[model samples]
Target: MKKFIGLMVIGLTALMVLSGCGDQKEQETSSGTKETLTVMASGVKNGTQGVFLEQFKQMVEKEYPELTVETTLLPDDQYLTALKSKLSTGQAPDLFLVQPKKASANSVEELAKAGYLEDLSDLENWDKIKDQGKNDMSFEGKPYALSSSISVLGTWYNKDLFKQHKIDLPTNWQAFLAACETLKQAGVTPIVMGDKDSFMIQFGMYQVAANQVYPSNPQFDDQLYTGETKLTDDVWVKTVTMYNELYKKGYVTDKSLGLGQPQAQQSFVDQEAAMIFDGDFSLTAIENDNFDLGFMAMPANEEGETYLSAATGAGYAISKKSQHKETLKAVFNKMTDGQSEMFTNWLATATSFTTYAEGDDLNPVFEEIVPAFEAGRSFYWSNQAWPSGTETEMQAKFSEMIGAGKLKPIDVTEAMQKKFEELTK
Candidate 1:
């Protein structure tokens, strides 16, 4: 969170969808009269982000002088469910924002491939965006979305608090556990965690699996795609077993599994918990806590390393189904180039660093842990990077496994094995 209540408090839904379903089409909004470019983004439009976006819109109208745009904000834990509902009613917004998160990606891509999202492969400014940020929607060698920024996911903690607790920061798996155990005995909940939101598990899973898949080890994703390696390999077992042990140890708070993300974060902020395993979004984790915070990725295993996490947000996609393409492209261009800087500033204000470029300043949390951030092992998180539908079943099973107390480190890998066989077909 950088999302106050969930990742939702951040309120950048339409912004998130930029990559998954962008399309380019002919102009419809008259030079001044206006053809409305209705947009769908989740979250309230009254914050600093709204102001920045509004400013961008004003400038676009002044600069382009031919378009009028309208935006709608949708918020709910059932975000994807809402998008799906819109599709069935045949009322998808002219241009809606999406995230690489499961439902968002699945719906957006299907819509795009099926000619719902405008094929923006020819946008003039496409080259300006970063390649890594576009990983979600660069399908079949053609660009489908306008990805503007990138954010890295790592564990955030209060350094001053760590010192006060007299615990050394962890650098490896053993070290990680020692610190967690130390916190436990001290009446400090080792981790402020929540799986109420499915995406949360992805962070945990990535912490354990990214290094194994980093730089393209087809041993997992690729093999599953091609029906090569079995999912029930030793790798899966080791991964799941790690989680199983962690859960069995009472390291996590009991309320965590029951609490939604927002509450979980507030608990951490209140100091009910000592450490939180999360991403840059932690900026908003403790909305009430002005306390100094520190951040780094999941502590290392025996290798004392982790894969760098690249999560999704603020991607622009053209609706292939839209009758008006030019205006849409123009709107996106304005949104990405003119408005993005300001809009991202608000997001940065609301949370931490999400944009690819510089903002007002680095989140204080990032400042404290910069040394560890640059050092140690890092990898591209696998969950966000996986092809569509690759990990849905696995994630669901993982949650079930955790609640059932039937999981182990190896099960993480094994569950993938089971999931792969079902998914590939």
Candidate 2:
């Protein structure tokens, strides 16, 4: 009897083990093999790109139940360093952020040249991208990244302050200067710039360059690359001089070199300043202020000519070494198809103008600058076409000119030319 009882117990134990193994196999078949896609970028957790990343992960997982997405976001400097290290070490993420053209260390052209970016030419939504955006993310005539939005850089001004001081919106360089003078005379800060951040310099200077440099010579940057034109040329000198005049005349806030971009933005939000130069991406920071706001292209041109400094914003590029190429490609196709729920969510979350046809209704604040786009009077941000370090050189020299008054406009241009030569070589 004891022997029989022991045999029964053994049989039940074996049956239970087999049943557990069968259930495990069934679960694996039902759910499929799990895979993970990795993405990396430079942005804050709640920033536009961050929000987009979260949405992308959710949508992708919903569509492919067996896939998981992992994201790592760092500050700009740290991201650049980490991305370069990872790419070199053969451990880069499946998809990573890259600047348009040669605009940064991790730009599409540079990575494509280094044979790190995957060719995305055959993406399903390839034809839907605007020509300019396509060009911005292309290298050697092949698309390497997916650019989704157009970033417009312009003046974000407090409408209440402008009205309180009885100042009309300026449509030309002379009028702009006059308005500044009027605002200064009224004891209002005409503009607030955070020169301490260095990059803030580009916000105002690029607008001036769009008018003074590109209108007559749209090929200036191309010529620069080919050694056909130089930064020390008269046009750049004039561009620098025109932008410097604002600082020289004390129209910008005092001690601007000590303030950071956030502080300057806060000043504008608090209505302590009439204007701040920024891109459409900054809307989230300034949009919620109690007073009304307006955005317009800085009219740095003469009376009849108008130009806007705009460009394709940063976007994602796929690593050539990624094992999940097909999955990443599918994500891009679905997100930018111009018809998917993901596409609609992306348009709403994007702070910049949509590159696709579906999202054309811009915020009321950007309405004033629509004419420039319609008239084809918009130029890509000057630095977008230049080598990566060119803007850094410009920022440093321009800050010297503003803070110490030690560098003249000509000196600034000469320094830029030297840096450009060194970088190109």
Candidate 3:
């Protein structure tokens, strides 16, 4: 019952925010002063970023007597498309977006270097938030973008299903198989997936791959990218082998191929699958489903080592073309008020931790998994860390290998090396 109500709220919030709420809705609001700001946000419905916009109205706009703001929401998939036109023309949004990815990230760094992002250095609270928000959210020892929140991801599961079916959660390769077999015997799917969105499959691959690639340290894929190490390294092969085995064993839900997020998510909500390996953002869906979800790392290797599921949030960038630097700064300062509040609320409720020091109470579930991630010192999300097309190529090749019956651990390692080679050359 709780899950049903939660899902209803989740569905409505998503629907209202996306559908007719006008892609660009400017409240007929006013500040007694002369400054009125037009804020452009990336994607109104997906990503917690939208929640910032919606909450901004109630929290910032209503409270500030001297500042007025409007919002223009764009879809995430098309954010770049719209951003190109807007940024090229000087009439771009006062604030836009940036999330670090593998390929085009250098360009993002370039943008920040070139002053395409508003510098909040002069803000009053800048010093207060810097200790936690600096490295992960912003760059160059400055708060170019405030992270509001950061997170760790891994295997999200339903504890009730696991207990009822008497299947222990797997912590290693062999144990994982045993658990899956037990679930299968009980007519419960071991995992739920939504491969209709390619990123879902990619994230699964990345989560498993991270363990093999970065079993122990801050280096994660940073070294691999810089050639400090090679993917043909044994660990990479084993990572691919581990995940492919799960796929072969029928542990991952078959509906994953046919379903997009919503439809596929039903498998978990309906309790047909015991687990799904996704990120913190999926918490909204989980709350909506009202399931008593639990989480753990992707089962580790024989040595009790595993990788991490982690990625930074999309950073908000100033329009390269905006003429209102001073005005933008003022508006952005106000946005921070909105950003910070939303950041804490969203993260605390969503099982994520913010890099921001002034964090909200941790989600109850995060308490269980956070320590494991930190203790392991495991890290990396390949697509987020690598270049853009690298993910497309590598993930596609991974799926093809699995489908083709040739995706061994070593094959995965070799394939990563080849893909990385192609991308670099």
> Candidate 3, which ten residues in sequence have the lowest lDDT sum?
1-10
Candidate 1 per-residue C-alpha lDDT over 124-218 given as tens digits, one digit per residue, 9 for 90 to 100: 55554545445555665666665443455667676666887787877767777888888888877877677786566666666666544443353
334-368 per-residue lDDT for model 2 (tens digits):
65767756566545544557667544768878898
lDDT to native, each model: 0.55, 0.78, 0.57
**Distance from true position, residue 3, model 2, in Å?**
77
Residue 149, candidate 2: Cα error in Å is 0.7
Best by TM-score: 2
Error of 2 at 376 (Å): 0.7
TM-score of 3: 0.78
> Which residue pairs show collisions in model 3?
3-290, 6-288, 7-288, 98-315, 102-386, 102-387, 103-387, 103-388, 211-307, 237-409
- Give the distance in Å from residue 268's predicted Cα in candidate 3 to where it truly belongs: 0.4
Q: Model 3 over residues 1-425: C-alpha lDDT tens digits?
A: 00010100111121112211211223233543434555555544554556656655444444443446666666544655666666656566666556543324322454567566666677655554424345544557665654444455577788887788776767676787788888888888888877666567665676776666665545656787678877777666666677777777888876566676666667777887888777665676765445577867777566664556665555555564554455445443433343543223433432365544454466677666666645645454565556455656556666666566655557656766777778777
Off by over 4 Å in 1: 1-34, 43-70, 75-78, 85-90, 100-109, 212-219, 287-290, 334-361, 368-377, 385-392, 407-415
Alpha-carbon deviation at 79 in model 3, angstroms: 0.8
> TM-score of predicted model 2?
0.89
Q: Least lDDT summed over 10 consecutive residues: which range in candidate 1? A: 2-11
